[model samples]
Target: MTTVPAVSPAPSAAPAAGSPAEAAAPRRRRFPAWLAVVPLLAFTALSFGVPALAMLNGAFTAKDPSGGASHYTTANMTASLGGAYLTALTGSVKLSAVSAVIAAVLGLLLGQAVVTSRHQTLREAVLTASGVLANFGGVPLAFAFVATLGNAGVLTTHLHLADHGWSLYSFWGLVITYLYFLIPLMVLTVVPALDGLRAQWREAAQNNGATTFQYWRHVALPVLTPSLLGGFVLLFGSAFAAYATAAAMVGSSVPLVTLQIADAISGNVLIGQENVALALSLDMVLVAGLVMAVYLPLQRRSARWLD
Candidate 1:
């Protein structure tokens, strides 16, 4: 038997590294990140952007002194920039600032307390209360404040606050009423951020012989500052834009920007003052825009740590 040597199999050609067959890993690519917010953006544009643009356009438009029709003018801007409108703007700023700062401080303490609490039921109860209170604004809130602090209110009548120089119609009274919801809203905002704080970070700080104050100042606070500031900005905006509460509570006694806008639209007997209301709206929107511009960057920074 002639044993012929088995022929070696012919060498097979290997695929090049760049060839599709050799590319086992799928091509690395990313989905459009903005797709996540597209619906939100769409809703905002339709509900917010459209109305805002219309208001902005109307801000410059004026009644034609000659033709008795609408025409472009700058008088609205000039008028809104000074006089009662300016005073109302300043009042709004002062009130919003005071309320926001108070709410921020109180909310931070409340949030931290809830986060550190051992009782889950207590936490849930507090959060539920907060959620309800945060939404409890506008007419109902005003009514509640009136019932509690008004001249004939339970607290006022029973306690005789009037005798003691307390007045619910005053600026300070408005701040107190605003705090009812603002503090709870701040709690809702900051609690989640507080939750984002990892226990390990605290442990790490402690292992390094860090004191409680040192840990909070160096680690916890830096992470928390952005969220605190963002919440404060939101509270400020909410206060600034509020109308129904102030309207139902104090009316024109307080020269708030919201009141000024409402007056310009409804109560003003002056012809062509409707344009001035739109101008006031424009100013408010500008201020809100500036505030949000500041808040957006802080929010982005905070999200990095929290997320």
Candidate 2:
């Protein structure tokens, strides 16, 4: 049996460096990641970028009174930042600040309670409700509040709230109405941060002879400050940009920037003020940009601790 030595199969050759197949391997892996983000980028460009560019063009450009042509000018921006427009902007800021403060405080307390509770079902239920209520705003929310707390509302009539000077269309009333959704939104925003707290930290605080209040005051609050400030900023921005709810609830009584913008757009206050509306929109964008500037840093700081 002089069989020849069996030869093993030869190993396949390695792919050449920079070959098309080798180069294509990385691209194939990256394609899905880019695919996922491309839609988002396209949507943002269409929905936000295009409109923002148009707003900028309109804000600095003025139409001829004789309807002859358009020209670039700063009068619209000037008018947006002065006189009654300034007053409306101020009112909106105040309203947003007040609502955000109240909501942040109350939401913090409520979220803490929910987080510390031992009942899983209760936690899930509260979180689910918060998510729903957080998103439940706009005209429907306005109508619901009006029907429940308006001048001739059922609650107002039965509870005699109207007799006690409880007007739902006043500034304070708008604050109360804003709280309906804002608190829930704060709850949603802060709950994750609350959950990120470590049990070991609390144990360590207690092992150091710290009381519950001392633990939270000295240890937890410092860690949670960024999250709290971030929540406040989110709530403030929400209240500031809100349009339909305030429009429906208080109409011109509140003097919100949003209402003024609407007036300018519709020519309700002055004809040919469409450019002015765009200018007001620009002002709002700047305010929103400032708010986000504060918020993003806080979010990054919080992520260092929580995430």
Residue pairs clashing in model 1 are none
Q: Which ranges in model 2 have alpha carbons more than 4 Å from their true place?
A: 1-40, 297-307
Score residue 183 of candidate 1 by CA lDDT. 97
Clashes of each: 0, 0
Q: Which candidate is the best by TM-score?
A: 2
For candidate 1, which ten residues in a row score worst on lDDT?
266-275
Model 2 local distance difference test score: 0.91
lDDT of 1 by residue, 1-307 (tens): 8999999999988878888787886677788998999999999999989998899889999877787787788889899989889999999999999999999999999999999999999999999999999989899999998989998999999988899999999999999999999999999999998998899999999999999999999899889988898899989999999999999999988889899888889866465588899999999989888888988887788667655
Model 2: residue 86 alpha-carbon error in angstroms: 0.9
Q: Rate the local accuracy (lDDT) of all candidates.
A: 0.91, 0.91
